[model samples]
Target: MNPRVIGTVRSHLVSRDQCPKYGDTSMPPVWIELAPDFEPAATDLQVGDAILVLTWMHKGDQAVLRCHPQGNRKLPMRGIFSTRSPDRPTPIGLHAVRILGREGLRLKVHPLEVIDGTPVIDIKPDNATLQGTAEFSSLVNPDTGQAILSAARDGWLRGLFAGFNGNVSMRQGERVVITATGSAKGHLGPRDLAVVDLATGTPLTSVRASSELAVHLEVYRNQPLARAIVHTHPPKLLALSLRGEGPLLDLPLFEGRVFADKLTRVPAHRPGTPELGQAVGVASRDFEAVFMDNHGLVCRGETMTQALGLSEELESLAGIAMRR
Candidate 1:
């Protein structure tokens, strides 16, 4: 029996030679345009969900039974079943991707290396094997983790973090859910985050914790009321710091003063070091936000919303300060 084609991939890749051996985060965005009759099947899918997309590689060489791995001529020839060659008898392509967005019948996904116009045979939720690299802890709240992800995306879209220069975390009792090192804040997937012990900073999952985990742990140690933290390199703040601005809280407007009364200034120390963490942590005890010399800003709040809001407020205030 023949499988029905429910959708077709819209990608920049036009041929097998243009595709990478394996899909990765560096690949461009791809759209799976489902037929009108098949749109109902995708109603349960949401942005940020991990999914497995099965595509029929129409351009593949179905006659080939064996080939070199990844088309490398030097590698020993392997049977089609033993390799991920697109020239298999079935020529079915399985891609593990994250849903970036959904617009009507078109779903935009990332890291899909399939050729343009490839027929999509099926779509399903990613299993544990797909996300095995990062083991999520049962003790950590999923809702809180999603919130942290939202905050990270917001910060990236707001130009708070340049590249992957910042990290976000939330305290949940004795554990902290945090973004993994080098994770793209705006395009985070399930495996891009991890949970760690709050006191010892030991990661609970196989995924490694952020390099600045020390700072988050120290802040939690000093501020018992803080449940969330946001660290970002806001452009305006960084520029002002470079100009030798004395205090980030010294704003011209009265509302700015009131909005940031608890903002404090911390001396510069090597980032990701215990000294820097200690300095920020001590300052966060009395202040809601800290401006580090030659560094960036760190803010804490009762929730991630509050923490992100405080960081945004400081960035806006910094922009105002720069205009003067």
Candidate 2:
């Protein structure tokens, strides 16, 4: 069987040596100029859509079957298929990228490390239909999944961060429904959420849980009354934090007086680490809201709505304090 090229990559990197071994969120945008005939195949794609881009790595060596990982000569060589090395018998390159925009048949995407003029093979939406190893538990009901999506989008609309920088979760007995790791919170879909067992921190769904799952689990374990958690980086709050303002109790609003009783500040700890999770968990025993130094905020409540409301209230108060 022969595969035909449908497009050519337009990138500043002219050689494979100039490309990153793996692309990250900060990489510059590159254009995929598809053939005019393929316009119909890409018409449905829109900005912010997650997609998989298939390309032919023309510079790869088909005869090389094994190589050291990441060019680390100190490490042992492994089969090319076992690693992400571009060189292989087929030399097919797969990249998970977000559609930055589209002008006619030229689609702009981010974090793609392919060289200039590479042959584009196919494009597919990175949606929930992709299967995984997770065996979902019975606790992830429809309502729970929808609630998590709603909260994630709400937090995203609230301008918490520029991208998928926060996480939201709701407890269901021994398991919790959480936003998937690296998922664009503002554009979350059914596949962007995960169900994980709280006791063992193991996923019960096809997707992996947020990296901050440890922090959520700790809060649930420490606060029996807490049923939901919302973690976000409010711009105003982060600004205040940079100005050495660690507490939000200075506001003159009525909600400030109420939240102050349940508000506390925790020293900054590296995110997604056990230390951060422990510090937030200890603070959760008394404070419904936690101000993490140099980080953001973590709010817990008896319901998802309450937790989200508390986060909104605190952010509003921060905005007020900033103006004052």
Candidate 3:
């Protein structure tokens, strides 16, 4: 069945300048009313599940395109296609948002660069294949299937982490392998990492990578579609999680329903234990970003890019909430 457009995107900040310049803005909360027959997949969502986010470019002034070829603030002129401007010939924007969570029809999404109140055109599942060069590893005893390890070794794992500007690592059996370099490493440490056989709970490898790994592993086990995960301790998300507050309801500056049914909150877990992993797994059942009480935030997707996008979205929402 074709996916349906269940929500309208509206902008909290109506001014053109306030709109997102890049396709990475933290979208204000917008409401999404699900179709009567629609249902989210079971097994919860992982860090990297592909989602086709349909958004209405409410602030897009299609008429303005005739004046400038490109919406380059710095350049004198370029065509709309030449630059990533929202004022396109067609004012429709489709973003792939990682599922944060769902509450009835409300879905909490991440990394939607559209302006607030933009009407959502539709949402579909993105089943794109992973690239050949993506780095991957096997996980022993994946909760779902026996070939989970083979899937990883064969690179069947989706490219969930693509285009992420962060440090990430992987674990196979007893080894911890760093996947990226530089700033990614600065945010993670060896002491914060750990690995274990999914079925047996036997220790395989452990390192101080990031306390957030607990959440990542949980989503991997619980969410069938999740192939990659990202955890970021950005100040905005951290502050919001630290507040130990309730779910984001009203969009004071922007619509809140855009993220309807997609956000979730997970109380902090005991560091470095199967319990923590189980908590993350449970929380990830349907949401992307699971606000870790007093710790940080965790986001899952079918790919790394989606996961990172959700992380950035959570941070943006946190920032918006803080300002309020």
Q: Which stretches of candidate 1 lie over 4 Å from their true place?
A: 1-139
Candidate 1 accuracy as lDDT: 0.84
Q: Compute the lDDT of residue 95 as modeled in candidate 3.
A: 75
* Best candidate according to lDDT: 1
lDDT of 2 at 151: 87
Each prediction's Cα lDDT score?
0.84, 0.82, 0.50
Q: Which of the predicted structures, 1 or 3, would earn the higher lDDT when compared with the native?
A: 1
| lDDT of candidate 2 over 236-297, digit per residue (tens) | 88787788754555766787788777779899899999999999999999899998988898
On the 0 to 100 scale, the lDDT of residue 289 in model 2 is: 92
lDDT tens per residue, model 1, 1-324: 347999999999998889999876787799999999987787756665567899998888899999999999999998999998889789898887777778988999988998899999999876554345443333345567778888999999999987888899988757788888988899876677787877788776777778888889999999998999999988898888888657665776887878679788888898889999999999988999988778888999999999999899889988888888
Q: Which residue pairs in candidate 1 collide?
A: none
Model 2 ranges with Cα > 4 A deviation: 1-139
Cα RMSD to the true fold for all candidates:
12.7, 16.2, 19.4
- Candidate 2 vs candidate 3: the lDDT winner is 2
lDDT accuracy of residue 164 in candidate 2: 77
Error of 3 at 94 (Å): 49
